[model samples]
Target chain A: MSVLYSCSHLDSPHSPLPPTYPSSSSSYHQLDKLYFCEECDAVRCDQCVAVEIASYFCPNCLFDVPSANVRADKNRCARSCFSCPTCESSLSIQASDVPTESGQPGPPYSLICSGCRWSSKEVGWSFEKPTGIALQLQKMNHQTEIVQSEFDSLKEHLESYISLSTPAPSAPSSIRSTRDPSRQISHLTQMAQKALHRDVGGMVAYSARSKGRSTGKEGEKEKYGWDELGVYEAKGSWRAGGESVLDGVDILRDLEDSGAGGMAEVGKRWGKSWDNSKMTKDVLPQRIPLQTKLTKRCPHPNCRHLLIQPDTKSIRMKIKMVAANYLPLVEIGRRRRRIPSNDMNEASEQPTTEELERRRRERRRTRGGIPIKEEDESMGLPLKRGETYLFQLALTNPLYDPIQIRLTQPHAAKDVNTWCNVSIPTQHFTINALKDAWAYDEEEEEGNDDFLIGGSEAGFSEEGTTTTGGGSGMGTLGKKSRLSILGGQGTKKGRDRETGVEKRSNTSKVILLVEVLPDNNTGDRVRFDLEVRYTYKSDEMATPTEPGEGSGNGEKRGKKEEYKNFTFWIRIDLGVVE
Target chain B: MGAFDPIATYEKGTYIETDTGNKVSRKATITGATNIILGGKSIIQTGSILRGDLRRSTAGQHVVITMGRYCLIGEGAIVRPPGKMYKGSFTFYPLRISDFVQIGPNSIIEAASIGSGVEIGKNCIIGKFVIIKDLAVILPDTVLPEGTVVPSMSVWSGNPGKLVDTLPETYQEAMEAKCKSYYQRFRAT
Candidate 1:
């Protein structure tokens, strides 16, 4: 037999070869025959496969693209394998013709390295279209700008024409009248004569008639009586000299004549007889009867007298007369007996001639004597030039009433001169003086004595000049009188040591003692204690100068500084005085 | 002898065996001689070569080696004892295997063990004493160094045979179990 030669390496020659097989076929046939590139790891067939294509580089190397391009393409590189559109790199094609489902041929494609499998499709090659709605919006915006400019120009033209037009002279008057018709009518009448030359009488009469008609609508409705219209027409005809018609005159005349005659007669009698005393006596008797008689005649059986009497019968006339006469006589006798003639004199023991003389002397002494030194010091008494001493008289008395003090100075003068008037209240004295009088002059002595005497120049009397033996008389008054004097004087010198001492040691103590006592003004009535502060300045001090110095030379220049010289307050209880 | 037995004639150094107990020797150089076992109905394509002491290995019955499977083996893809030694220290390196594994014509595998359901790509260099776990994928033209261990279900590529990624767990498991079931079925037969 012929040896079979096989491609199998086990035997070189054989009578019958097993088969002729290729050397590579053994391994290739056993494998799946799929080619896998480890670099790209993409499978490809032999025919369509390409190597090292630049645009086919995979995603891993694409990140190396320059930042500008990265932003332009939204961080994606273009499709260049050798030079990554994103990050440039040398290209290596890992795949050839990858078979399609139809088995059609195609160019080889590449894949990225295993790190990132980004494909060529992810790069900047994709196309997109702008939306239709965005284009329409741009057109609308352009149209709005044109319309706005046209409106602005129209407004400006209207404003310029308004300013340049001439204003009508009568425009204000017309507008004013339009607001109020009544005012317009009156104003038109005034202006028509001056400006329009219109008739005033016709317009005024028309306006008055219109006003009357308008007001008549609001008047109360009146019912017409026959006599009222008749009298009015009759009077009108009479006043017009009887030629005018009087349609109802006869009836009015008869009614007036009848009523007037009766009223006149009654008025005549009343006027003649109605004296106040007589009328009162006639209308009001001594006593009125309790009941009135209802029947015309006396309702007694067999009574001949048919006179009517009061319903209530009277008591006995003799008894009434006796009681009336005796009651009055007894009252007279009692009054006569109660009368004490010189009994009052004897019971009270009329003062003897010597006692009377002594009392009179005491009165005289109190009235004229100089106040004691201690009293003067305690009362803060100061000397009044003509009056000799400080004294208080009753505010209502005819003689020696306390006077109000007044100070006067010019608006330009700093120092004021004071005067006192006995007629006004003492409290108003200073206030009055400050309001009147001009600058005082040393050379003008005409009113000086009158002022010093505490008398109004208009009412000055010689009796106010009575001498009281110097200042000692100011001290001898009673405690109340002393207090009044001190209170007045202390008001002027409240800041001085002597006055303050006298106030603290004496006045306050006296006030306290008086306050503790029962008030007699209203004999224990409810009252409020009122305390008031009063301040005043004393007389200017007279400073002596050197023998050769002139009086005018000592006068100070510039404005004098005003000082609060004294301040004092008084407390008094006011209510019903007890 | 049965008609189903492979009619292979071995030369001086070649060793051959069939599914039905016929044996043949040939002139090819075979190292580390040991027993050859063939399953009941399995077929080995022609032009396939293998060199290793495979006394500890097995082939399932009814296993088919196709024509492309044969060419892959001839291109130095390895199946049984799928690794070899270069400098001879008993350390093994794996060969490249693709979607399907095969024994190439005139190729040697000096490694200690081979994984089941492994796919060895064509034109591979396998080193000595390497352990290849079950269902591993070896890409074409990959060379594994000696003493390397290819883990189970891994897809390996590159010259040094580093792992690319693991095969899907279910796929790997099914393939491995199918190999075992075939082995069991053949043994039962």
Candidate 2:
């Protein structure tokens, strides 16, 4: 079972969020990817955290580009690292095969894509030296110079009205750049302004008169006429080479002549060189776009603690407040489907795969968004309706000291139409403390293997094997198996080990029996939430003063020890009934 | 289906377990054992090839393949030192593979250095001098070009392998867990 923990941001920690809201799945994430804020005592996901770039580096060259140079280089590599325009793979520099008169080897070098064997010679770009190709391209590329000047002129033209005008009310709308990217050199200032979330100096500005915009008559213009600020007269050079329409016609004709093979994909047209490279031949090798290491902070305005601060030189994180260290790693696996008995429900008959598919299609028509894992049995097969299946809900305690876990099913949302019968047989269990890797190996030799493979027969504390009932008596009761510090090794294996429970190292695997109820409709969703509150001794807390807030079934601890209670919710989607 | 269901099982004499916990399959093609260094708990699976004979030309007993702990060379994978022409002579470079590196089945790796937690998926052709940094994933059937530099956290895929995505920050922990579990599961039964 693929599990996702709920990050109930709005809900109070005391109140468990009822799994009713549509798109609640969006708030769920894998425990490992989630962050923990110590102050808030809540889980923080990627969506909730604030992100800032830690460092910029070239993916191709692996060069750590300084932040200053990132802006100057337009967030792309300034070095000789370029990706092939055709295949989008990094290019390698190759020297000219034909030697000069002196036969002194390399002088004229060209970038070539080893994947596609596409050479820079296609674009007639041959550099004298191989080292600094981007620098050389800056001097040689006259087209970009013209484009940059044009962008500057357009920005300068718009800056006039913006300087003289009042503040605009509707400022959140993206400021559209003047250039279409059909030409070279996209306006970097607009991009930079957008990145910084700064208000762009623009033409449309609200005045005192426009503040009372409701007073204006329908289909009538304002007296100031801010809409028609100025006419952009085309520059002389642009007007002189105003053959763009004819050029488009020529490109269309070329497309007709060469077919679809001549065209470039939309993804290839953007990135380093944001150009109208419709044709494969028009695409030029661009400097590889830079990648950034992000520094994430807790999004809470008050508690802006560093969640992740990646080091510039190393892959290590300077400050990582990951939830994995603080919370129990919950994994639902070991799915065992019960064999359908003849006397029970065989007379009622089961729905075939085709019937289920058709009903699923009908359900899809009504609700098109909720994604269900269909047909891919790599992770798990679909849970069949009217059949009882056994699952192991394994909780791995990350703490050095052993943890007591209490599992309870949260009351389902109002809709009982699409629900299942979930029976968590063993409500409470204790996982052994996480020790060094070698400690487990030594412990195994000492014969602590009975707990690793649980016994399904009867409860035996001395054997370290508790809980007897399996799927036969799924929801027998809320049985609390108090497994005290498992002392000196018990050598014997579980006499008759079954599928109900298993434990290894710091992980405790308990049986979770789920009976998929038909509830009239088969294709609708049947998911349930499990409330897991783990109590672990807090090493840093002052013990004598703090009362370990008596949660239900509180086990008395040593006077010097303090217990910390943490509660989290997990939603398990028992796949559609077959 | 489950951890209880062993990920892999073999005959009693299928693998020869080294003192450092390195398990080398008897069927694996290993050359010049003296030049090869397998860090503790590594597994060289059946039919996999490790070329330790292809050491540096100027060396006297040079270590060729220096693999770190919990490394898995999958079935049919070939790992050899990267070779280059230097000063009118062809010489080999030592292949350094760090901890928790899982080279999947049928992958041919001629990379110079593979950092810790790097996983190369099945049928990948990792070309010569490819410097894969920590926590990078080379997806299955990927063909990385020669001298390609794969930085940390990036996932490379497709024929001409490009940075398709990135790994989560907790990938190192996950990789370590996976490697350890796989090592535990792989045993002589």
Candidate 3:
């Protein structure tokens, strides 16, 4: 697993065919890429978000393109910003030092790629000014004019044939007289039938189709003889000295002479210079394409709330609804293998034998007290089946107010091969509210006396965790009551043997016992899902509108308390079984 | 997937505090220590290499590496001044690192100047003459090109680093707290 943790999208959470279930591919996105929709209370991924282009700017020059000019410019930079045809890097304008008739160095410039040292002079291109190279190339290039005239002539030749096939409003009377008698009678009957029943839509289409056909029997006016139809040649109308069938042969010879490095890649030739047939030398530089800032909205029909609103001037998103901000950050790190209780008893019975010597070596092997392992290495080791390992599960609250979290394993995981049991040592615990980092230093120095007083003033001391859950209520009595509830409950302080790691702060850590049971059909890996439900107090206060107060009693304001709960699931993959 | 990391337990005195209030680890290799000037409360973690011997060719007592206050060079990180050919001979340029600059573990920084409040993530390669402006974050594994100009408040990531995102308005305060907390957490057994 990667450092990034994400929620798996259970597409068919209630599918009956668990054995043949198709897992969703969206289970592996980084937290930064996932968006959260508050309205739908569901995570919206990139696959589901409706992306709309907010602004388009050239990646090289960073100039915003006008919407009207986007189509004309073919969604590329119009301000003479061309990338290298070979390296695809932005090309810079370099001026040449050729002397002019005025006895001064000329102001002639050429497009040059600094990365590959490719210059426009190689292709015999030079310009008086640095700007508008594309416009100048189109004006002076003779090959482009020939291709343009050829396309125009083809369109002109096909104009009459296209118009002739179209349905005509008026048919010539001389051509109608020379038409086939049998076919003319059938056409007349259909037209007469349509006239008799004008409301019939089916007969209208039949008459329209018949009118589109040109009658071959109509040769009365001799507009074109049957022999003349075969002599129509579109290529004969080409501009003088433009139609050269030897152009392909000449290009092939040039390609055979040039080096392989001179030819552009298929990707580079496909963009902008699409009609450039000379593969080796004719590939021209293209304008840098524009990049867009996207505005993503929820795809849900009922709730189309904005998910991502990117700022145009800066890289910051104006409205970034990432799921990481909403969900509690969970990190699992410390790993330690547990030695069986029976093994210790067996070692004690051996006294000075080889078994006792082996125990001494084992203690030396684990001499680091708590073996420090890398996150990747710790997960790499296989866990023995039918063994129980103690771990610490910590939850950090993202809100300003203290939150109560309830974590549980579901009865069944959809299509997993194996499942493990997770036992929480402490069922209910309150996590401290997030505060400014410097404030923590001050709170630590004042000791627990001031802390207890502050907790009571918040009126949240009853079921509170000492650092966070205190508010105005029973004052000092509230702190005493909470102490009594936790007293003798073995809320284990400091370190414990067999427990991997322990530390206390705004992040609440609790001991968890994960037991992998021995199975007849054993699998290499064991995976399970955890359901996390958290209840947090809403910041928005509601006031009761009762009329029991005295007149002008706005000074004695009362606040209503509101709380909300959210549930999400996380899958944990315990790699390999010994 | 859920395993508690044992090494994170705080153990005091991992860093040796000098008379100047700079917390420098004894394990850190500091060559030409006389040429390095570290401002107060700066940290040089274990296995870090600080090369202060590379000086200008024509210089008379040039300070090769100068780090300002609250700077942290993480474990296994390397800080070396950029050098280039000058007047037909090679010369090393001075690396000036401003206050509140935290270079993450295993990062190799040869930049000319690193501005204040710039936090470079782990395994980043800051190329020669790279000018990083204040309040910038170079994400993990970013390999910036030579002469890259990193603008203020921008977040750069990936190889041949591109501007990926911008820092929030409260980034300065957040970064200061994070650096302070990391320094506080480093301790010896």
Candidate 4:
């Protein structure tokens, strides 16, 4: 029911095209999600884009947290923003209900959750002031202080051991050369005259350095890549397996009464991995995490150009090279299935199907005659086997100048689930250039409106049901004027009744016939990929090529308009067949 | 797609139409008429309640409920301002709902500010002082807690209202078009 373009992840411009297997969900993306790298001339998806944080800000307070304090603040709001421990929503500081001697609200302020009606009073956390609550909480123990002090003591204990283990920079190199005989101390040899340590090298120097350096503690440092630390003096406070298990008996008793409803969910304990509480009541409110705006670049190391650069101060992007600007918008609409006709016009919606059947009959009359199905017009009906369905694929030109589009099935799609032959009646077509509403004359509007009212099947269908992103804010009047131009004279493709393809304004609609084949997997939606190659004016002037290929009219010899071709693959999904 | 949908014709005298094209249903209950301001082209459906009476205790004139253009308050929805005790006294804060915001049926919104192009689905309980930024979507049956800040271009869902996904860049224009089309489709039979 939707169309998604595939990104190959890497682009090698001159190499032969690789067969695209777009069945993988990760490889396909909507046009808006894709970026076009001009240097490489290829589409890039999020998977192939390099992202770097530009700025960090708190979602709740909207404060731009400075980079220096980001680590110290632990990527949370520095001021007074905190979520509720119970519901995880942001908490509000409320004054206590008790009245003062002056008949004003009391000084005791507490955090409250309006959602679950949770209060800090239950946890014995009452602040003298409503503001700067985080600073006030820091003064209290909260178990964090205990953990911090123990970690500090451990670091101090290891300080002396690390310093003694480190070899001094001024130490005699003769001892180091003695430890490793293979290493030549070239610099030490230059300073050898000042201190004649050459005899100090080799066997005797080895014995001097090996006395204390042979300990594996030095090797353990290199093996595990741990930082050098000092002395280890075990304290009475630090005892292994010393905590009592009987203290948790109350928690078990509470669990028996309240069941698992008293327990905290896994998501609530995400950032509190160091000391997470199993009981919901024991969990305390934490600061909300900060969000970041990221700058995106092409993943290619050689071609690391900025694809998206967001402004640090605002939501606006300084530079964006989205693929929507470069590619033609393709949309499939006006779906109709072919039904058995008793009596219909000889010049039907499809002339090619009748011609092909006639040719097949002439070649082999012994075979059963092929039945010509009529256009049913009613859409959303389950497709029948051996029936033909016609679809209108509208390609809106993105460029200001006219472009020629050639849509072809590169090869038979290898999808095993769906069985349907999708064919394009008109392989090649030229779409008009996109223009502003004011640029289009009013006469054209009236002319196209007539087509809409007169065209039998076009008064009110899902004309704007675009498979991709909808049309850019073109006024309703302009869009209606150019939606249908049926029975108009001197059109480029004059045979509208035969090919069933029409053109109005910048959009060109083509007839796509899908013939359903009987299969066991008829429940699956019919899907296929199309390779669209568009030839557009490149606008190169430095070294212009021959001017004959500019606009197909072989005109404008003086003007330098080089044409370039770009090809991209798109996968379309049709609803399930009956 | 909304442009192709059938016109939603309401019976005559059901909705009172203003010169600014705002449609206020006759059956809807609107309190504190002097404190509420409905922007041009907005619609208040039947059974909806706008509590503009929850104004500040101060004597001077103050707009309590200020809704913006093209906003839609669905049936049975409650729009009330958030109030709290500040400086030894209780005072109500003004609720500002901006342009193109659609609050679905039976939802209760006591938020301080609901920004432009926000779509709050049916049966949602938007808590007090919840500031939902532009182009955000709160899914149906969501229970957003008090002071929850829903950022721009994000989708919020679930009881506690955690961000689930983000909207595309084109969502702003798409939402504007949808709101405009829906307003145009709504008419008198």
Candidate 5:
């Protein structure tokens, strides 16, 4: 029988395609390989199989089986077939079992159908059986049961053992006995050592012993002999290698070897050396009055010792020098001399009243000096105006100081009749120079003052002329005004752009007062008021531009200009004399 | 036939409506046995089989019936009884069901929860009583061991079903926020 197979180059194995068969009149074609039915062990192609197949089959049975046969097989009775011993299902014999030809036994098994209760025993066929999975499963189940029982028993035994082994009440006692005794002994020893070191007097003795050991024998010997080494000597002079009583001494000595050598010997012979004629005064021990009497007792009255000894003359000179240099006794002596004594008080009983008054006067003269008049006034300089001065005035002073001026009129004078009032309006400019425009003209050879009002040519007669003085014709006035107007126009045109513009109002004011000095320099001061109006003008002309634009273009022009026509006017008011 | 027997015999191209309103087409051989319940509104595709009693059980409202729910008999999945019994008295039948679960297409859930909010990747096997909790994610071809309990909000994958990580509770919210931010970042254009 021929089985159909379509061989296409479609890469995937899962692609769907129609099976082909071998026929002259149809599209079917034949394939070379044969396929077998698992139930019957019959090999055939796609055209030969008559029964329908359900389980996975060879390609031949897939195409040849009818749909009705497959359905019938699905519904077939399971009891009609013998059952397989291994799987408990009917089977179809695919091949016969081989005979046991060798000494070794062959497999003794039969094929069964996995679907229905069909077995190969109906076809009288058998095959060798290898180890069956069913037998292995039974063995595993038995083993699992045995292991489970053993595990259960083991768990029970462990639980009982744990319960029986719980600790009793003697555990702490046992632990204490096991501890080592040597450790405790060491701890006690350390505590005792610490206690001993903490006793205060014992600690002091220990420290003293340590100090003594550190210092050793050399320090002790030095401490014992220090007093002898400190002593000084006074004795006879000595030649080199000759015995001298003043050996190892710090004392006054002379260069000559006069048998009386040191400071003490020289002092003793001082009287003997003087000539009898020079010492004609009596040789009696001179009674020297006390240079400094003890006035009050020493400040430290509780000190039992007297500050100066009663026999001051008997003190050895060397001892006195040592006492003065090293002891505080000298300071005590000085203090006693400064304070007044309670006994033998001279001030209370000796001096008479006149004598006491005279002594007081002498002390006053020495402490306070005589007074002088001019010196007192010279100390204070009087306040002066215009020259800045610092003034100090009392309320009763004749002239009130400027600082006492009232807030409302700080510059007003205090005395009304004696005060000078000068009306000095702020001067805005100073008058420097003036020039006459027609100075070179021959017809105008007169001085520039001739053009001023009230000059000699003021009333000159002419044909159409009215009086040229105060009551002039308005026509001449108009003509003269035109000349001024023309002059102003020319000036405006000549001025720089910065200067040509008029100034805005509200300029600041600064007062300038001109005082005319009196002829005798003491007469009343005459004052003149000059109102000088100042306007700043620049020499450089401004560049023209659009209305809103700034002076950036003019600044770019490379020219530097100074101040140009600064006009000043002098207006005088004869106001006051000071 | 007994109540445990297969109620409907399925053939290729034949459509059968399950108790859960799902339309299933048989693509391979199958035997229906005892105690099976199929969920509603699901589909069973080609090369898949269902066997065993599912009538007494409960299927969630939106379950998918591509394969079983508890234990997936996998692709090329075979649902058959044990090969042999100890004695002639023993009769065997394997139980297959799609319980409370949402299975992706081509997944074989044999005996597992397939759980609420669970997303199974294509072609996965689930063993018996494996309670995959809510919102669990199973990657493709993952095999779950028997009696394993997957905690809630987790991802389980790999052959032995190791836990990957617990899913974030605000995972959806974060995703939405990221989308909104992305839109806002480019919205100026």
Candidate 6:
């Protein structure tokens, strides 16, 4: 199941060490999830890519939340977007039948869930306008106001304590004590000026300090207790009179007795309202949370290229460097059993009626077995010991240039049983150049004739036999051999017929003969790794350098078509053995 | 054939082109065609069932399945309007499918609204009353539960689909081009 090929033993030009550190497990991922870093020439998965937020927008309203306003809105939708207290579905604005005094049909709006039929009217909530429901709800709720005022008073009380706890200011003998009336007079003048300027906050602080200092008895100069700060209560406070905590406890106990049916979920309670109301009936509708877009970058510190740069408003990536675009798309399918000619021998030998009946039962049993009998069947076929299965391994070249592919099984340890021996009939094959669909069709027709003639002749005679055939007439002989090779092409045609695979548009398919050994002890599933080495001309490496900068002008002028070979490994998990 | 992949090739003339430039597969089962408003150049692939007969119970002419331009209803995909009990009566809601929304093969979409540039991959089941905002992608085999709200620029996947990733800003342009090209590539030869 390992989709990515990561090996420490492989020779890399970039890595300093041998990469023998405790590496992660085989990183398996889909093609879309993987990114290719061109700078590092490596594949990076989601686990390896560094992600950053691109933009934020409300999930329900789909309104783009500005980063500046995001904190103020507490990362929730500011518009008339509310989830149902029951089903959590987005609530739609429904207009009530009741009209205004003008009789203009200016009806009040109530939030309603189209899916669950849950309406805000059930909670006795209604809005004059369809939009700005959150703002209206905040103003209408008295419980929130009480909490806000209490929080403000507590913050104010803590502010005084924080300011007084700071180290005393270094005195220049000016404010050594109250005995220095000159310093005290200057301080009073500064406070008077602050008051004239209408700096109420500063004036109040000065007055409080003066009061604390004047009320202080002997030997209690610096010891200003909390009582002297005075009780800073919220204006029009009703919380103390009502005993809100005890009331809340009683309400919670009543809800608990009524069962969990009317209780809000933990996620629903924490979503928007900080009020920990246990009952779903008391739970206010929450604005949907905003979701953020992510921009992915290469995790490699030195090669931090933009792997995926997502646009905020669209489903497209501004810059997408998927590994599928750079690497060959390899697919394994079209499995067929290489059945031996045992049926021919059975046909020649006349069987008795009892034996024929037994054979019929055996055939029926085989048909009902786990390993399905079909040539075109693909995937999850049981692999039996001492049985050979022929599969089509197709390699599609992503590059425009025709690539030469070499596929082989990775060398396994001696202790590990070679459960399956996969042999590529055609080890080295050149894939066609990538082109348009029409161009491919035209090229294919012409290439077929050439391939048939050339392949047959090549298969028929050895290199030594061609040379010995003669000097001037060699071309004619080769052509004649090809023409005759078509019919008398012998075992080659049969082999070609048995391994029916083709290539198209930079895609080459070869028959992979997987012969299971007699001693396959790897249990139900047969797993193996394949090493594919492909050679392609790297035109990108030849960046035009300044003429005669380092090398001679002659060498610089010539185009350097460097053919590089890259090797990668992929693990194939062939399903259950019979 | 030299290098042709026979298994990969589709049958020629499988799709029947209408006068409005819509390449609708002849095999597709489209009911109540009069009620289905297909904007120009939209493709309805083979075996796709568009339930246009499911209209609102209210006594009025309603367009049950209204698709925008360049939208592709993939092979075998079912596009139906979501229905629910409203005011003591079950009523099928009108489905609004915006432009450049490509629904993959075998997906069942019972959504209220599918916004522009949205791609629902193969074998996805978009549940009833689902509202998918613009530029969203529902990955293959995702099963979104009922009443799921998919936001704009988000990627949703898995059963009871959760928002996994967000679409990039350039997605609209890319989807438009992709739909256009896919339409052009589908030849009736």
Q: Give the number of the best model, judged by lDDT.
A: 2
The residue-by-residue lDDT of candidate 2 on A1-578, one tens digit each, is: 46778776633453344555666777788888899877666788888899999999999888999999899898899999999888888899988877777664476899998788999999999999989999999999987787787778888988886653433553553233222341112223333333565534422322222443556644223433443347776454544654589878988899999899888877777642435447888888888889999999888787798999999999999988898888888877666665543433443456554554454344335333543222212234656665556676778888888788899876554233335556675787777678776776654444333533342224344454433433222123332211212222121213321323345556767777666665436565557788888887765543332222235333335565757777888887756555
Deviation of model 5 at A434, angstroms: 99
Per-residue lDDT for A485-538 in model 5, tens only? 322322221121111211101101122222122221233322111111122222
| Model 5 chain A worst lDDT window (10 residues) | A327-336
Scoring only chain A, what TM-score does candidate 6 earn? 0.61
> Each model's DockQ?
0.00, 0.51, 0.14, 0.37, 0.00, 0.19
Query: What's the true lDDT of residue A222 in model 1?
Result: 23
Top TM-score model = 2
- For A1-578, candidate 4 gives per-residue lDDT tens digits of 66777787874422122223334556677876788877666788888899998888887777888888899888888677788887777777887788888887767998888777889888888898878787888787456776676677877766654454344665786456436633334223323422563334544335434542476556523522332332455432433423346647877887888799888888777766656357887788888788877788988888899988877675457977787767887877667765544442232444354554653344234223554444645445666665667777778776787788898875646333345666776788787677664544443444333333223444434333222212222233354433333113214232233344466566677878776665525676666777888877866554332221233433334567666777778877766777
In order, the Cα lDDT scores of the candidates are 0.29, 0.72, 0.62, 0.70, 0.30, 0.65
Q: Which structure is stronger by lDDT: 5 or 6?
A: 6
Q: Each candidate's chain B TM-score? A: 0.51, 0.96, 0.90, 0.97, 0.52, 0.92
- Candidate 2 vs candidate 5, TM-score winner: 2
What local lDDT score does residue A422 receive in model 1, on the 0 to 100 scale?
A: 15
Reference-based TM-score of each model = 0.18, 0.79, 0.61, 0.74, 0.18, 0.63
In model 2, where do residues sit more than 4 Å from their true spots? Answer: A14-21, A100-104, A160-230, A236-253, A271-277, A340-379, A413-415, A444-501, A519-526, A542-560, B1-7
| Model 5 lDDT, full chain set | 0.30
Mind giving the per-residue lDDT tens digits that candidate 3 earns over A1-578? 22333343323122122111335224534444667776666655677778898888776566778778898777888787776666555577766767567654456788887546778887777887878776777678766576667667767766664455333655665456435464444445445544575422344335543443354435312322211212345543434434366876776677678766556577766753425463646677777777676888987777788988877777467987876666666655444455554545454432442543464456435635745331223656777765556555667666776777787654454335444555665656666566565555544333323222221223223323433222222224543453432221112222231232222334566666565655513445555556666776664453232111112322233354556566665555566677
CAPRI rating of model 6: incorrect
1 or 4, greater by lDDT: 4
Candidate 5 chain B weakest lDDT stretch, 10 residues: B1-10
Note the residue pairs that clash in candidate 6. Answer: A311-B168, A311-B169, A312-B169, A315-B171, A316-B171, A524-A577
Q: How many clashes does the backbone of model 3 have?
A: 17
Candidate 5: how large is its RMSD?
Answer: 62.5
lDDT of 1 by residue, A3-87 (tens): 1101111221111211121232221110111222211211212221222211211132212333344433333324322222211
Measured with C-alpha atoms, the lDDT of residue A505 in candidate 2 is 53
